[model samples]
Target: AKLVAATHNPGKVPEIAALLDGRFEIVTAGQLGLPEPEETESTFVGNALLKARHAADLSGLPALADDSGLSVKALDGAPGIYSARWAGPGKDFAMAMDKVAERIEATGTEDYAAWFTSALAVAWPNGPAVVVEGRVDGSLVFPGRGTRGFGYDPVFIPAGESLTFGEMEPTAKDAMSHRARAFAKLKAALFD
Candidate 1:
C-alpha cells in the first residue's frame, strides 16, 4: 500500500522510510504539492494528529506524522513543542543550543537531565486515527559534539550512552532512537 509521510524535511524522510521500509510505498507531502499544515496544538499528540489528518484528507491516503522534542525536567518541559521554533525561522540549531545551555547554567544546577519525546500519529482517510509515543531519557551537555544528527542531537546524550546522538552513526542512533520506538509501535499496530 502507498502511504503519505506528512512532512517535507528530506532528512526525516529517509529516517522514517528506513523504519517503514518494505511495508509501504512511502511518499512525502511535497511530492503531492501539499502545503505544510500549521501546528497550532499545545501537545505532541495534537500536533501530530493535525498534520497527519490534514495530509490524509488532502492526499486521500494514509498519512503519518511525528512531533518530537527535548523536554528538560528542570525547565518544566520547556522547548517541548517549540523545539523547532526555539531554533528560529532559519532553523539555526546552534543558537538554540547556546540558549538552552545558557538557561541551564543560569540555574546553577548542573542537573542536565532531559528526555527526548516523540509522538507518532497515523490518520486514515475514513478511519479513526491512532497515536503512539516514545521517549529516551538522558542528560544534556555543553559544547555540543559530533555532526551526525541534527536539532539538539549534539548536546543530548541518551541514557547509558557516552556519545550524543550527533556523535553516533545514523544506523546506531536509529536502532534505539525515541522515534524508532514510536514508529515500531505504529508499525506493529498496522502490520503485526
Candidate 2:
C-alpha cells in the first residue's frame, strides 16, 4: 500500500521510514507536493491528526503524521508544541538551544529535567483515524554536545543515560527515541 508521510521535514522522513520498513512504500508529502497544514491545535495529538487527515485527503492514501516537541518540567512544559518555531524560520536550532539554556539559567533553579514527546496519528481516506503517543524522559544539559541528531537532541540525556541523544549513533538513538516508541505502537495497531 502507498503511505503518505505528512511532513516536509527531511529529517523526520528517514527515521519514520526506517521504523515502518517493509510495511508500506512510504512517500513524503513533499514528494506529492502536499503542503504542511497549519498546526493550530494546542496538543500534539490534535495537530498530528489534523496533518494526517489533510495528507490523506490530498493524496487519497493512508497517511501518517507526527507532532513532537521538547517539554521541560521546569519550563511548565513550554516549548512543548513549539519546538520547531522556537528556533524560527531559518531552522536555527542553536538559537533555540541558547534560548532554552538562558531560560533555565534565569529560573534560578538548576532543574534541567525535560522530556521529548512524540504523538503519531494515522488517517485513512474513509476510515477512523488513530493516534498514539510516546515519550523519552531525559534531562537537559548546558553546553550542548554532539552533532548527530537535530533540534534539542544535543542537550537531552535520555533516562538512565549520561550521553545526549545527539551523541549516540542514529541506529542507537532510533532504537529508543520517542518517535520510535510511538511508531512501534502505531505499527502494532495497524499491522499486528
Candidate 3:
C-alpha cells in the first residue's frame, strides 16, 4: 500500500516512514507536488487532521500528517503550535534555539522545563480520519547540542537522558521521541 505523508518537511518523512515499519510505501505531499495547507487550527490534532484531509482529498489516497512542537513550561507552552514559525521563514533552528535561550533569560528564572508534543492524524480520501497525540517531558539546554535531529532537537534533553535528541543516534532517539510515542498509539489503533 502507498501512504501519503502529508508534510513538505523532508526531515519528518524518514522518521515517519521508519515508524511505519515498512507496512506501506511512503510518499510525501512535497513529492506529490501537493501544496501545504495552512494550519489554521489552534490545536495539534486539528492541524494534523487538516493537513491529512487536504492531502488525502487532493491525492485520492490515504494520508498521514503530524503536527509536532516544543512547548516550554517556563514560557507557558509558548511556541507550541508555532514551533516551525519560530525558526523563521528559512527554518533556521540554530537561530530559533538562540531565540529560545534569549527568551528564557528574559524570564529571569532557571525553570527550563519543557516538553515535545506530537499529534498524528490519518485520513482517507473523502472519508473519515483518526487522530492521536503523544508527549515527552524534558528540559532545555543552552548553546544547543549535537546535529542529529531536526527542529528543536538540539536544545531538548528528554527527561531521563543527558544527550539531546540531536546528539542521540537516530534509532536511540526514535525509541523515545514524541513522534515515536504517537506512532505507537497510531499503530495500535490502526495497524495492529
Best by lDDT: 3
Q: On residues 42-68, what C-alpha lDDT tens digit does candidate 2 reach at each position?
A: 999999999999999889999999999
Which candidate would rank higher by lDDT, 1 or 3? 3
TM-score of 1: 0.96
List per-prediction Cα lDDT, in the order shown. Answer: 0.89, 0.91, 0.93
lDDT sort, best first: 3, 2, 1
Clash pairs for candidate 3: none
Worst 10 residues of 3 by lDDT: 8-17
Look at candidate 1 and tell me the lDDT of residue 108: 86
Candidate closer to the true structure by lDDT (higher is better), 2 or 3: 3
lDDT of 1 by residue, 1-192 (tens): 999989866767877888786678998999999999999999999999999999999999999998889998878898899999899888899999998988888888878999998899999986779999988899998899999877899998999999999899988888888888998898888778
Model 3 stretches astray by more than 4 angstroms: none
True-structure lDDT of candidate 1: 0.89
Q: Positional deviation of 23 in candidate 2, in angstroms?
A: 1.4
